[model samples]
Target chain A: MSARRGKLWSRTVFLLILVTVAGVVLLPILYFLTISFASNYEAYQFPAKILPTFSYPARLRYNADTENYTLLLKKGADFEAVKTTSDASDFSLYCKSQLNVLISPPAVQTLFDRAKASDQAVPIKLRKDFFRNYVVFFILAEGTMRALFNSLKAAGWTILISLVLGGVTGYILARYKFRFSTTFSTSLLVVRMFPAVALSLPLVVYIMRMNLYDTPFALAIVYSVPNIALTAWITSSIFKGISVELEEAAMVFGATRLKTLRTITLPLAFPAIVASSLYAFLAAWNDSITALIMTNDNPTLALLVYRTVGSSTIPNLPAAGAVVLLIPSLVFTFIIKNYINQLWGKVAL
Target chain B: MSYLKLSSLKKTYPNGVTAVKDIDLEIEKGEFVVLLGPSGCGKTTTLRMLAGLEEVTEGSIVLDGKDITHLPPRQRDISMIFQSYAVWPHMTVAENIAYPLKLRKMDKRAIASKVEEVAKICKIVDYLDRYPAQLSGGQRQRVAVARALAVNSKLSLMDEPLSNLDAKLRVSVRTFLKEIHRNTGATTIFVTHDQAEAMALADRIVVMNEGRVEQVGSTREIYNECGSLFTAQFMGTPPANIQKVALASSRGRLVAAAGGGEGAMPLDLGDRSAFPGMEGLIGNEVFLAVRPENIAIGEPDGVNEASIEIVEPQGAYTILVTRVLGGEWKIMLEGDVDFRIGQKVSLKIDPGKVMFYDAQSTKRISLS
Candidate 1:
């Protein structure tokens, strides 16, 4: 009975830890999503909302003694007078700027006349266009779509270059023994020790000399420098796990060396290769400092999103941009998740 | 001309260690030859050289009248079954069998038919669409065999393929492999450390020690007529009993005396005429090897007397262990004969089957 109670206690503690970890990771993402859908006015509201709402309940009243119209917004159960305006254009501009609720001057004037006629307080429902922030970010922000394309191209080239060069180096390291092989493998890790930001500065000179500056290809070259080492380190262990006899079997059964590599070694190492490609993709897609130093006219989406954070006082626009930047990484990870599962399953065997 | 010939083949690693030293062999067409030795005895190295997986450091390999000493494995037109089976995990069983045929540029229809044929032979037809990961180890081994068979290459090489299976599975697979070889008639070179496996499967066994071949002959010849002390100690379940003793004539009968001085006892080895040319080496020390089955236990003969120390019943036969020449010696008797420990018995060794070896060189000495 004591053992059973102890097990139950441990299970409860484990569940608590799991929930805490999930909240810590997911709450920030949830907040970011809500802010991306928020209006400029909702962005500054105190005690921020966890979820976005489509419509706000409020009342419009005419104050005959003050000779002005008053807007009362519902906060919880009570209403509070938020703004007062007599001019139609002023009311229209206030709704558009503060409320993110579009109202034409003529429409505001009609509402004002109706409120003036009715001595009682008039109920009004203010509706907001939910996806306005996202639409405006793409349509109004210059070079945003181009930045998305640049990030994609850079990541693609990085995957291709890193897989081709690192995979061969990894296979050679795993399969062969030579003088100073340990030293050579250790030296690859040494290359990864230098910060990518430090290397990007010197690489820009070569990029300019080669006339490839401000291009996604130049960004790929810088990203691949560190990613190649990481890919080699990851793939070498996986290649070692694959038996050499498998490759030799292919060769003995009429396959040439290159054919053996293509058929046997690469397929066996594919899950690791896909995993390394994900590392390479994230390195190129999420890197902003390197892009800041290496690129000027052609910026990656991550760089654009970073610039958006500094320029905007309201967080909604930049949050929308960040959400846009998150999409490709999520899709890439989702697609290769099955392959990673296979890697784990194979290891268990 | 032989179907395959390796002339003075040698292998020396870059680390200054020689794995194979001056191996010369000729193989006839359709012969199943087994290279048998313990681990690190260069048997696998010799097989790898034949498969072109290892570079021949010194000599030439002529296959079907063509010099292929430096050629790569693919150019050699051979198929090998690895000890690990080495079946591709990603491919289905059918694809694994069809890959080599496809590489040889066979048409799709022919490849499919060939795959079905070999899969039927290997008893893996029911698992044609299943991947290797889904198959058991024994089934994967069959897939590997089927893959090698589908190629129908000039030569087939197996490197300890049965060592990975369980004991019972190993015996069944051994019979299955022998049956396949009989039906296929492909010239095969099999490498293994199991003496029984080699004896069971080989048309001829090449027994190796260290880096060179000790002897190469049929199973019966290797067992009954060992050319070297290594082969005699190597090719049996219980192994031959060998002892160093001095040869002397006792009353005109050849006798081997063990345990020098007054404590020495003479093992009467029948008439002097049985071993010709025995007079020259009188009183000289030589190694005497006697098979356990050849040593008969009987009433006290007043010549070679010993007390039984232990008895082991193996269902089919019984082994009696006794002290002889200051060492434990085993004797085999049929049908679990009642022999109790500490029982006094006399041992009579068969004179015609007795073998003598030169103590210095460890080589067999022919007396007839």
Candidate 2:
């Protein structure tokens, strides 16, 4: 074959391989979203609907007497029988239903009611679409988002604290020779392998005694503990590869130890510190079990997602929340993909 | 007054290897001294001790009238260019040259001017902004020189600094270093195993051997009148040849063999009363030490004959190896004197150039 033909053939094969691999990876995600939005009736039908062809209708009870349903506090004993008993004279129940159940937060619920009452009481067709599921998913997602925000807040603090502490500890371990330097270095790894969950009960009791339970501060400390050894070992190895001669050269030029570290040694080590911080961030972000065990009232997204998953009789909404949960981590990993490769190369044995 | 002096220096490692054993040498100001020896000869150790990099196990190192053995390397005002050219790889040539001045807290403007001045002298001005990894080997060596010079220290210690370069570059750098030493007039202590470098660059060469000083003298003095057998063997390219010869008394006078088979030839001993120690024995053994270059092919009045065994034609001179009586010997012939192999050729060894040593002790004896 001619060289041009040969080149064209090879490129076509390469692109075909890439596209096929991408299609395989992306297919399951596309399939899950398609089925999640399909009507529940259609989903359970003889042959499952791969696409939404028709909308399903849902039924809700309204009182003919009061013409309103109370949203909160149905007197505990009448909680299950609240499907009836609405009377037109009970304006408080009507206002409560209008504000709490029929409308959402961060906006005037009355405006939505006005928009609804000015139109039909059916309100946007009452069709059994993904919005009903989305409405529930959004609430859970907000809790998840708060949990996400809390985890991010805790992780941001963890990475910052770990980088400073871990960098100093690593430099001392790698460069200086003290009487017990080896013993000190070995203990870092020992602390990392300590089972965190084994200490969780005691930690929770301690946090409660300190009045730190359900706070992001306590969760951040828990997350930072596991990262100390990992950051130390990784940063120490990088510091070891940097020749002490370079630092001494700076010292000869009148730089003190700290000055030398700031000017010469730290610049060379910046990439490694960044890599370690990313690792610490991911560790804190993905730690669900610790966050769940440590917190109660101010639960993170992982805890909220768990609560949503646990309470659901059916798994569809939770599965939808799970799909949403994976998005931020995916986007974060994609954005820092190059740094991940570099950090991996630096830390890998 | 000497700029640097080492007073009875001693260095012993932790495991008890005495690298430099009681060495004493004084270097005058502006003088270039080279410590030359084979590996493990303690030359490098002594230089390090002087540079304040290595600790002195015993004795004091005084530089410019101040005792500095206990001082650190940076405080001693001594600059050292390592064998590996210890240039910081991350820094540019300008930055490296400016480093010492920066250490002294010199003003930025002055440091820049000094760096430019030294860079121009080393002819690396154009390469100032480039990092060390970008420069050629010769350029890096020049940068190392510039960095050392920028400090303007009292003493400069160079440890085989040009050993890494190619031969042509080595010669150029060697010449440049000599010129720099002369212009700056800094007391320099260079260490090298290359004899040619020591011979070319030193004002006084201190020959070391196995942790002790073998000889210390000018280049000509060491070559002409070597104090030990090691010095004589080490200084020359082909080295001096030593052979055992039977000295016999003729007419109650002692003389060594003059190269005829089995007592047929004899050398005249001028005085009988002299060398009275030979009275008890008419025959004894002695060592004849002569350099290869001192021996010639043809007879020159007081000469001997030996059968040529092999002839080697080097570019400047031809060396003939010949067997005389019981043993083989070598002689250097002037120019391209192509004497055929296995030819019985007349050879001349100038008696004045030959040295005498005791056969058993290998110690120099009374020449008369």
Candidate 3:
């Protein structure tokens, strides 16, 4: 092939591969976001809709023989049909359930009277509440907001422990060649693969004995065990890529080894540190299994969201909680996305 | 004692690999010394020991009358420029240059002025606020040099700092480094594998081999009067040609004869002054080393005659390659001297320039 044609063909292939990978990754998040935005009526609708409707489409059916009209509106499960005479003033009930539209007695009377005069069923649209599910999850749910705070607190503490402890371990593993370094590093990874349930079940006894069960701090302690190991492995690879000469250069210029680390080595490895912290944050923010076994009175938002999957029949509220659980992780991951680009390359010293 | 003295210095890793053998070097104040060798020759390891980056397994390093062998790099009062040009990417050029001063608890104003002075000297004044990533490779190297010069440390160590640059840029940067050395006069120890760079920049070159220092002398001495077979083979570009020969009788006279069996040729011994205690050992084997430039070429009337195989023009000089004792002997002629291919040529090696090494030990046999 000609050079130009070959280049064009390769570029086209690259673009196709890129678009396919993006779709595979983003399609689930898009569906979850749509589900979170749905109302109770939309959530239970069969053959689920990919988009949410802010208003309900309904019609007032008038039976001329009976002089009665039936207002068919979608409520919790599906479309519910209500039949009544023209004098009935229960139109507000349908307004609140379907439209979340508020109307006074006289205004509701006007709506029914207009339907009574028309022999044909009046085609009327009801405006539904846009953010009711979100409001219910964040403002109305009893422990959801508190659980969100608990998740944040746990993630924050996890990041702190991981960065401090894991950072030191990684630096030593990268720079020093002490005896048992290999065995120690390998064991750190092997410990991560142990079942969290088995460990947490046994550890919860100690946790409750210390009067620390059902606290976010207790859950954070459990979450940090695996995450710190992962952080160490990641940061150690990155720290190894950073040249030891940079640290020596600083030390040769009148800075102590500790000062050199603080000034030169740490800053050069900042991208890796940021990426590792994001991993720790997500581990603590999205964990449910550990939170399930470790906490009761003060469960994390993720645990609460997981519980709603079994308790709530409708998925709207639970999906809304899941959305909330996802926001912090998504935001933190996006902020460090550029830093994670350094994951594949040798981190420049 | 010299300003900087390394006595019985050695480095043996915990894994039992000796990177630097016992080394004793005394460098005077303001001397620019170079450690020149091929890879794995312990040149870089010695510089690292001097910079306190590597631990000395034994002995001591004395600088300015103070023993600093066990001292940390920060307490040793030294500065180093690395081969990788390790400019801190997080800091701006100005901050990188001023960090040492800040570590010493210098006031802000003095640090700024000192940074400005070194930046101006290194010609990086305009790049003070830009980070290292914003600069080119050569600019980053200047930043490294500027940071090293900013501190005014007692000694400066450089490990192949210019090797990363392009050939054209390396030459210019080499001049710039030399200029900085002359202006600062910091006792400097530079390590490089390139012999040309050592000859161009060093006051004295310490050639190393297999974790041992082969010789230490002025560049002229290293090139013209090599002390060992290794130095002779290492210092020259089209390296000196070597062949095994023995003093034997041809017509009741002593002459150096090629040890090669086929059509063995008798060559002149040049002078007997170089032979002090070898009267009885005339028939034993000896190694002859001759620099390309020292071989005079014209007519087929000298001590050894050989057929010219190829002539290479090197702009300033032309090199003639010939087979001597079944080996390629290169003869360098000044300025476009043409020698036709496949022609017989007689080459005379200057008696004073010719070097003889013990055939077994490979150490130079100096005339007593």
Candidate 4:
């Protein structure tokens, strides 16, 4: 009984911790998503709502003595009265201007007629468009689609270069013993500590000199400078954990050094490679400072979204662009998360 | 000429530690030789040198009349089974076995057939489609063997291949390895710290100690006539008893006297007829070595006597750890013996099996 009580107490504590952590991680994202879906009016509203609401409350009241109807729409705090209608035909333009809601004159006429016949106030509702912000960001916004493609092309190239170059360095560092192997591996990490932005600032001159300044490929090269070092560190530790005997077994079984690496070593280190590629992808996908300095005409989607912070008064379109940018990163991160689980979870050796 | 020769083969690491020091050996074609040693004795290092995995500091490895000491492993045309099995986890059993055959640029149909043939021999045919992660440890071991067998290389080297398996699986795999070797007749060099494994698998056993070869001989020779004090103490289940003893003549016959702390007593071990020229050295201090199995329990007839310190009954044989010669001496009795601690018993040593070593050098003092 005491053990069960203790277990229950611990479980409660663990659940508390879990809920707190999830809340901390998810609240900001939820708010951002809410903003991305917000209408232009709601985006300007102070202290935003957590969920996007589609409809506004309305009421039509009848004065029994005068036999006239009054239409009132709920805005922020108070009920706003539209123009008094003796004839029901005048509700269309007044409804359009006051609520931003389009109603046909015939429907407004019918609503007013019902309110005039009724002794009590009649309740009505107005519906708004839910996907207007998304449409505005993706389709209406100029060059957003092109910027998205630029982000993709840059991320793809970064993954390619980082894996090819860094994987080789990692394999060499893990397998070989030389006079300066320790020094060389430590230097790879030391290079990682230098900021990518600082590197990109100087590299842009070279990119322009090579006439590759506004291309995604040039941006990728700058991003890969830091990404390659990180990929090397991750892959080298993973490769070191895989026994050298596996490689030697391949070599002794009629495989050349290159063949051994291709068949035995690389395949065993695939999880780490995927994980490192995800790092490279994220570095290119999320980087704005490097993208800002590195390109002008070929702006990545992240930079375009970052540029919106200064240019746009409302946050909805920019938040919508950020939501669009988050999808590919989220997908790659999920894959990388799974790969990391597989990396250390099982004993391949 | 021998099929493989290592002349003055040496290995000195960059940090200045010598792993295999001055190893000189020649192995015949189709011979199964075992490098037997304790940990850090450099048996695996010597084997790795042959496989072209480790570089030789000095000397040459000539295989089938061609020097291959400096060649890469793939060019050396050798196959090695690692202690960890080292079967590729990413590849299917068939793919792991077929990789080497494929690298030879063999046709797909031919490679498949070769893979199937080796898989059947290793008894991993049903598991051909499964990855190594799906196989059991012993099955993985067979897959490793099958992978090596697919190559049909000039030489096959194994580095403590059975050390990872459980006792029952180890024995079974040991037999499997021996059977494979017999069927293929591949010139093989196997490394293990296990003396029993060496005796079971080796055509010749090379006993190593402290980076040097102590002795290389057949199982029978290694057991009966250990060439050095190291081998004598190293190559037994309950290792051979070695003690400092003073040999002197008493009443015109040679006798052995214990020279150590505690249980010090003189022993009359009969005449020195087995050691033909040892009469002149009667007063000499020497090393006396005896196999635990060779000492027998006897009535007190005044040879060497000791009180039983402990009795360990291991079903087939009861091991009697006794206090004798100023130290604990192990004696093996064949069956259930009624004995107690602190009970005095006489011990008769087998004259033929009695091995003597030089007092200073610790080398076997060959009197005959």
Docking class of 1: medium
Candidate DockQ values, in order, are: 0.58, 0.13, 0.48, 0.48
Classify candidate 4 by CAPRI docking class: acceptable
Worst 10 residues of 3 chain A by lDDT: A340-349
Please give the CA lDDT of all the candidate structures.
0.89, 0.71, 0.83, 0.86
- Give one digit per residue, the lDDT tens place, for model 4 in B1-368: 99999999899998999998898999999999999999999999999999988999999999999999999898898988999999877778888898888888999999989998998898888989887888899999999999888889899999999999999999999999999999999999999999999999999999999999999999999998998999999989899988888898776556777866344887666665656778766878898888999998987766677888999999898999987677778998898878988888899887778888998899888866
Candidate 1, DockQ to 2 decimals? 0.58
Q: What fraction of the native alpha-carbon contacts across the interface, defined at 8 angstroms, is recovered by model 2? A: 0.14
lDDT by residue (A1-349, candidate 4, tens digit) is: 9999999999999999999999999999999998887766566667888887777688888877786778776667877675677765566665543334567888887887778777777898766656666666666557988999999999999999999999988987887788899888889888778887779888888999999999999999998988888888889998998898888888888888888877778777888898899889998999999888888888999998898766778788788888888988998788678766562214444
Best by TM-score: 1
Q: After superposition, how far is residue B7 of candidate 3 from its true place, in Å?
A: 1.1
How many residue pairs clash in all the candidates, one count each? Answer: 0, 7, 0, 0
lDDT of each residue in B1-368, candidate 2, tens digit only:
56677888899987789999999888888889999999999999998887665789998888999999888667788887777776766567898888778878899999999999999999999999887777888898899899889989888889899899999989988999999988998889999999889989999999999888888989887777777777777777777776567667666555566433365444333344655445543466666667888876664345355677888899788887876535566677678886777676566556556665666766666544
- Candidate 2 regions exceeding 4 Å error are A1-266, A269-281, A289-349, B242-289, B299-314, B317-347, B355-368
By lDDT, the best candidate is 1
What is the TM-score (0 to 1) of chain A in model 2?
A: 0.62
Best by DockQ: 1
Better of 2 and 3 by lDDT: 3
- Contacts from the true interface found in each model, as a fraction, amount to 0.68, 0.14, 0.73, 0.71
Instruction: Write the residue-wise lDDT of candidate 1 on A1-349 in tens digits.
Output: 9999999999999999999999999999999999998888688877788888787788899999999999998776788898898999998888877777888999888888889999988998788878878777886568888999999999999999999888888888998898899899889988888998889998999999999999999999999998888888889989999998988898998899889988888888988899999999999999999999989989999999899888889999999988898988999999988886463224343
Q: Which ten residues in a row have the lowest lDDT in candidate 2 chain B?
A: B263-272
